[model samples]
Target chain A: MNTTGPDSPSRRELFRMIGSVAGGAAMYQAMSTLGFAAESTYRGPVDLSGAPRGASVLILGAGIAGMTAAYELRNAGYKVQVLEYNHRAGGRNWSLRGGDTYTELGGFTQQCEFDEGLYLNPGPWRIPYHHRGLLSYCKKLGVPLEAFVQVNYNAYLHSSKAFGGKPQRYREIKADYQGHVAELLAKATRQSALDAAVSREDREKLLESLRDWGALDADFRYGANLLASERRGYAKEPGGGLTARPLPSQPIGLTDVLDSGLWQGIPSGDRYDMQTALFQPVGGMGRIGEAFARELGPLIRYNAKVVDIRQDVHGVTATYEDLAAPGTKLQARADWCLCTIPLTVLAQIPMNVGAALHAAISAVPYSSAVKVGLQFKRRFWEEDEHIYGGISYTDLPITNIAYPNTGYHSAGKGVLLGAYIWGQNAMEFTAMPPALRVRKAVEYGSRIHPQYPAEFDNGIAVAWHRSPFTLGCYGMWSEAARAQHYDNLCQVDGRIALAGEHASFIGGWQEGAVTSALDAIGRLHQRAIARGKKA
Target chain B: MSIRHVTIRLALAVLGLSAAAAQADDASFMPIADLGQANGEQIYQHICQGCHMPGGEGASGAGFYPKLAGDPRLASWQYAAVTVLNGRNAMPPFGLPEDRISETRTVHLSDAQVAEVVNYIRSHFGNTYADTLTAADIAPLPHPR
Candidate 1:
């Protein structure tokens, strides 16, 4: 059975078996010996050396994907040119600050009224530590990073149907739920209910672990005691002077905890992408895009929208209309083309790709999302609620209310992500006028934070469906669609290859765009070298 | 819990309900909050009108939303039903089955609701098609995954 013959478990499977038997650490070591478990696919800067002299590439969209390709290709001696639909670089990597004006489709224009230094990132806001490709560029571009708080124990978890529509503190719910579950399990263990599952000696050890893990008392029970209150906070906190004694808070009943549905919010921070050590650029997420723009200055042509993309045996040519001077069509041609235009917009453009690629392009439908930024007169979340940073989840149409992570305790004014609505809720919000959307967000958010009505100075709402640049938000791939057309979408068609968040597995993320661009260009480079040799 | 605490919680709940009711009474909030009981036109305005536009004269800029006004595609009631039920290109399926709908989806459309909206779209937007699609016609059409 252990023989290395046909029908034997492969090395990966063997390691997985080791993982099930030993643990993750031992399996990781075994896998690492086999050149696996390297985490992110990005090793370092892509080596696009030995480029054929004078090999030029015409890139579409000045997004992260396009810029990453241009920056690397240029250094590798490829004459690269990038055409952006928007006047700015960063397609979705955008931040709206004070004095900035945004005009969505249907002619609704909003000028940001946020105070100086206050901003709203309408796009990719948080960068996880595991997204090495994007982090590497942030480092290379000299963009300073700051901690982006994903979860705060003091933040809220609200459901309009639960707890009589009253919002609950995250820590209280988390502690109570864990304590009750542990207490129940301990009861089972002590009653010999786990006699078949656990060894006689291990039962005591499991109970001991549960007591500490669940904040249970010495008798392996959870109640309104100091031990439980220490985990969820005291009703009367310990003080420095007289009247210093702390009062233990009563825990909600197990049935109430189960019925509240607040337990769903507990594991959000434990998710791989949402785990701690997340970073954001100091000023805004747009800093990374701006830095890339500065680095690839003259190479990028802003306000040039590609209307037609055609390719032949010779090379690829793109017919673009310069938005500044509307009707006149300008042409750019190169040996190869890298199109980073989003699938939503690209499906509309006349790109001469094969039937499979075209079918793949039309297959993925972009998801609807709406983000509303409300500028308040003061930092009431900090001053009043003590919610310094992190998001509050709600069951209302306005799905989340994210407090600002930066400038904690600062006076004057602050901007909060009043709402991050998605799915059906987003569609409804998108249908409304921008002002009405903002008003609704305020109304809904007020349920969680009663200070909203008095504090809200102004707001700007961006409904991705109404956004003219990329039409809808990010590509939403059904498992079936990805299985059928993902490879076809990524493969090079004639002289053109596609790359963006849509083209990568890590959709709706900057890391997807970065990694996808690197992957596309690496293949493109190989093809170019081969073509160069043939030439 | 203490009696006083229970009383305070009840008061807060009452306040929240009244505030929501008052907002619902306001004309501005009518279109968005009452999706569960909205009519065909109301559903269109609340959902489909964003990308397709208020008049159904689709706008084009970064991407093109094909004009539904006098669109030959909607002439076939089955075409309209399938598109709304299964989605086509950039359009999201408004009539996905409850189990198929993503977790983020808060609203679900029934077959009758889908028919109602489809009929509304076909008749309005400068489009006049007498053939009304029934909920029975929509129920049996295969949803391509």
Candidate 2:
């Protein structure tokens, strides 16, 4: 019980000491022990080789989950058909460009007006390296990949109430914060404050590491010096000839660094999901969905909205209204059904399932989110501020501005994600009309990028709650709800099963859809085989 | 002052009262916490009107938003209060803790605010319920764990 004594080292302090002595690899190992890092469970493709002959599966919603199931099931010798509500293959995996029009729930239509070769991906945009399932499909489908920058040191971290509303460069904040922390730790070690935590031999090594890692001087202090400038950038460049002298920039005070709250933005890229080597599809996020559609062209029936779903001892049937021809009903039947419809819409459909599954269906609620994409007359962020291919965060309602990761230093107009708003902010933005949402985004974003007023050409805003296909952005599963209902939601009730991002632990991600589909179909295939054997 | 100037000042004064209570004057940005909206009408306009529509007549396309204007459910203020405090189906709970709802930033309505909005909706929008509910009524309602 005397763990607070000097002899007992806290886990955090032990990890920090290990990170200081060893390198990133040891730090990653320590993090892994604490359950901070999670690797993808995808090991190659799904093995569905034993699908029973004449067995059929009717998939609902041609989103990532539906398409993935259809593709894999068909390849495994099962006859599969997919019904989609939207005319397009990708439901939320959508990209908007010039000539594309969208009509939301309120009957307001917006036509994207970005120039050629410029588009906005309003859905799942980036694919992490560990998301082997989605990445494997990208490779198999011939969708080229490009690096998506998650963090740019040259980008800005701003607080409206701090720094007199002036933006601070991310590199300065990061370097100064690390340097000051290192200096303080070194001071503690020199004073023998960490004597019980570290051995005498390790203490010398720790001070040396602090000097190197923190850019501390001979006296083990972090201040205005050329070494600190090397990490945080120099005020004056070291020119070639006569003006070769460099002026070091002063580090912000530790108090100011802590008060500004810019430290919150530093660890964004360090998260497992947003780490480095993140990638995007070449054209847009929708390209992966398009590739799936191209592969499963005839099997997918678009613009088919299912009104009723019923299952008997023999098979499953879905009655859908063909939107192209209003008031006409058509039925699709199969031996098995894998429904990937979002629960928000599925709750309204008449489906026969157990009370447990029905309660699970009605338990989870979706989140409200808004994203605004603005087209500017020029690449002003790169040209003016030297910020290329990263996000600038602010406390304003327009949460953050993300610059286009591709087409760096090109001529013509550029597009920026002007706002990525969530929660109450999203609801407020959703309350306004489409045009007004765009205007308000431009107005709030102007506080960060002053060039917005003059350079704004055209913009489009999407409130996920107002979007007809998905009532809200993504499924929000409370801890209690997930504990009580998650397994029930995933279980197969009679001849039907459900799979999507909503059913998986990784919500709001394509990887979730892919992995959940694979998991669901794996079970469905086994059931189909078992039924065939019995029959 | 000119008549136009006087009218503009009067309008701004009314707006300022709400803004001062919210502790933010920017028309475009609304803070998530401590909204400080005065009454039920203002709270509904600031929060509920987005999905429920301006007149409480909900819209449907991709998903259905149930109409609240002439709904028979408002007859029982307890039903409305419980639903608002603990969401059903696709609607998130407006009165729960932010962490409980899995949202980092969301509208967290106090008991008084919930009562106000509930009372306002019950009386207006074609519903004539003279019964009134108070914060005391809402405070006792069971919340989802």
Interface RMSD of 2: 2.9
List model 2 lDDT by residue over A39-154, tens digit each.
66788889998777788999999999999999999999988999999989988888998889999886789999999988889877788899899899999999999999888999
Q: Docking quality tier of candidate 1?
A: acceptable
Off by over 4 Å in 1: A1-39, A533-535, B1-17, B23-38, B103-108
Best by TM-score: 2
Docking class of 2: acceptable
| Candidate 2 local Cα displacement, residue B44, angstroms | 2.1
Model number with the top DockQ: 2
Q: Encode model 1's per-residue lDDT on A1-535: one tens digit a residue.
A: 3225443333334334434443332101000011111245677899998898888899999999999999999999998999998999998999999999999887789999999999999877888899899999999989999999888889898877778778889899889978987887789889988677667777778788779878999899998999999989899998888989999999989877766666666666766677789999998999999999999999999889889999989889999998899898999999899999988888889988899999999888777888999999999999998998898887677778888889999979999999887666788789888999899889888888999999999999999988888988888777778889999999999889999988887788888889899999999999999886422
User: Can you list each candidate's DockQ?
Assistant: 0.40, 0.48
Q: In candidate 1 chain A, what residue range of length 10 has the lowest lDDT sum?
A: A26-35
lDDT of 1 by residue, B1-145 (tens): 2243346556766777677645434333333334556667777887788888888988777677777899999988888888887777766766665656552232457788788999999999889998777779888987653
